[model samples]
Target: MLHGQSNAWAIDYDNVYNDNNLPEDAHWVRTIGAMHVYNRPAMYPEAENTNWYVASGKAPDIRGGIQLVGNGMVGVLGLNIGLNLVASQNVPIAIINGAGGGGAIASYQKNDSGLNAAYGRLQHRLEASGLKLHIKAFIWNQGEGNAGDAVSDYKNALYQLYKNLSSDYTFEKFYLVQTPPGCSASSGHQTVREAQRQFAAEHLAVKIITRHGFPENPLFDGNYFLSDACHYHAHGYEMLAEWISNMAKYDFYNGTVDYQAPQLVRVIRESGKSLSIEFDKPIAVQPDLKVDGIVYSVKDQLFAINSKKIISISELKVDSKNNKILRITFKGKRLTKGAVITYVLGDTYPDTKEPYRGPWLVDADTGVGAVGFIKTID
Candidate 1:
């Protein structure tokens, strides 16, 4: 099951998979904005498209599964999820999506007093399929519309959603995709990201999917990663689906793989002149940040605040002894306990055409970026 706002619905040049050539009994549905369900059977050999394909066959297409009515925004990730599953495990998968683009978290909630349209749509789709009450998992990617709400309020609402969904449905796991850093109009975008981080830490079997990979050039005219600042291109959606499939492989299928993205395990102000930003796992320095011949300094996105005096960061690199610690260097100066450190500042660009702008330090092999954070030096 895939749910949430625009990213879930998709805004891309094209879908990751062409739905016309999917495997047997692999079907999907979409209830983004309105009901557009698809029940097409594009039966082909399991090995046909090893990397990408959509869903098809053996599902009742009650109400014509996934018809793009209005602008034909066709990049629902359910298709890629099904395709990857079938390709990797040869198991036909079914995906049910109930998402609305530009919707508030409150809107997706279960309102008992009145007609809950989102809830109704999902229930109807579940009933339409044979799996009336049970789903394998719920994959959620939301939080652009809740920009105005306080962090606490938004989190409370999300908690309400979690409660309602768990009570109302029978699903194994709930995967929450951390919101992409884009909504330039407000700082709420970062707030949403932070909220997601905290929420995932507190919950169990609840994984936070990092929708990473931003443009190498922060000032690029256009990005291949996203259709716009907020929405995803096919590349963006593909990255997201990859992680989802990765978790499934490692957790459920017992596949030997490292699917987790690197996050800040601890940040140590190791003396005055330097800070050791340690990750949960071994990490490597992304050697060149220069994009299109422009020198994009990694430290520009990083901030180290010393109240007594201003200390400019001289260098940021992987620690010599430890692969996990990001060694932040400065001239010989003492960083006090109350000094603050923040990453990816100035993330939003409201006035201009570009909306989301930030920097990242990525995983060595996978290129999965580290989570953006703002924390006081301790």
Candidate 2:
């Protein structure tokens, strides 16, 4: 199932901008409003009924609330990519699209009103499709409307959406697109983005499709926007579709997906003044922990040992035997028993070049941050 806002709906590809050409091999169905259904079958005897009809390029209006369709052009490039991925593996794919253009996360809760009512319709269509197709994944590309919402509120709402979907159906994985860099200057954008990052980091089943290295379309002179600064053009959509395909292919081929996050496992006292911090996974250590031939002092990188209190770290070294462990020596006062160390708390080190110095530890391979944790010396 594909859900979310305009991005998932492909609002940018409205009829005015481009034609919605149906792919020849694509076989899919879609729901219109609450009761009507439309199918775009690979072979046509064009299925039609009082409630069902054959879908055309422009049959189901983009403005219509909820829909389900075969993996065809259907405006949603991402869904098309998903369908193509399934087809490549010689499998049939059917998709249910429950998306609203300007919808917020709150609108899709268990019982939401207004345009968000699409969620209810989406559920009805899924139940109505008695094919008993095993759901593979729920592809979500939203969050722009909530760009101004508080991070905590957005996070909670997002979690609820995931829970709501899980309760409604059984699916293998959730593919969450790290929403585009919309209104980059908006505080809500950053908040929601960070919340998404943190959520994906903590949830094992949630696989995030990052937009980090995505390039702007050269057709737009490398500008991130298409016709509007908020949406993407054909080229941008193609790139995004490719990304979705890659992620889908990875998940489809392997029973398990790769998630890289440097998790803080525990903190052990090596001696009176030395401490060893262990992470759940191996990490990349900066070979040269020095700038301009001078070793960076513990005061420079070490943020806090216990309770946000700044303590000078006389020496800091990655353990020789275990790259996941970092050994630290205090300059003056030794850490007392039960001293809790906190690093990268909130968005503290906003400008730090080294991720290890920040509140969240970063995995070298994926550059994904580890969930921040508080560890007490034992």
Best by TM-score: 1
- Candidate 1 local lDDT, 1-378, one digit each (tens): 878876776643442244455444444332222333221122222111122223321222122334332211224465567667667886656666665554678767775522235665565555545564667778888887766455578778888888988877777778888776675545445567667766776788577667655444233243534534665556556667777887778777777865566777777878878888888766765544433344444664435363122336677788778888888888776777776665554344323445443446767656666665556676
Off by over 4 Å in 2: 12-24, 27-74, 112-116, 131-133, 255-378
Candidate 1 error regions (>4 Å): 15-74, 113-116, 127-134, 214-222, 225-227, 290-293, 302-311, 331-334, 348-359
TM-score each candidate.
0.77, 0.58
True-vs-predicted CA distance for residue 284, candidate 1, Å? 2.7
Candidate 2, residue 165: lDDT: 84
Task: Write the residue-wise lDDT of candidate 2 on 1-378 in tens digits.
Answer: 777766666644444333346554444433222221222111121121113322222223333534433222234454456445655665555555555455577666777432225565566556656522467788788887786566579788889888988887888888877653443333325456657766776788887764433343466545435434466555555566666665666677652424434556788887777888887666554332332234433345434665454646777767789778877787765667788775433221223322122212344554444434445678
Where does the lowest 10-residue lDDT sum fall in candidate 1?
Answer: 40-49
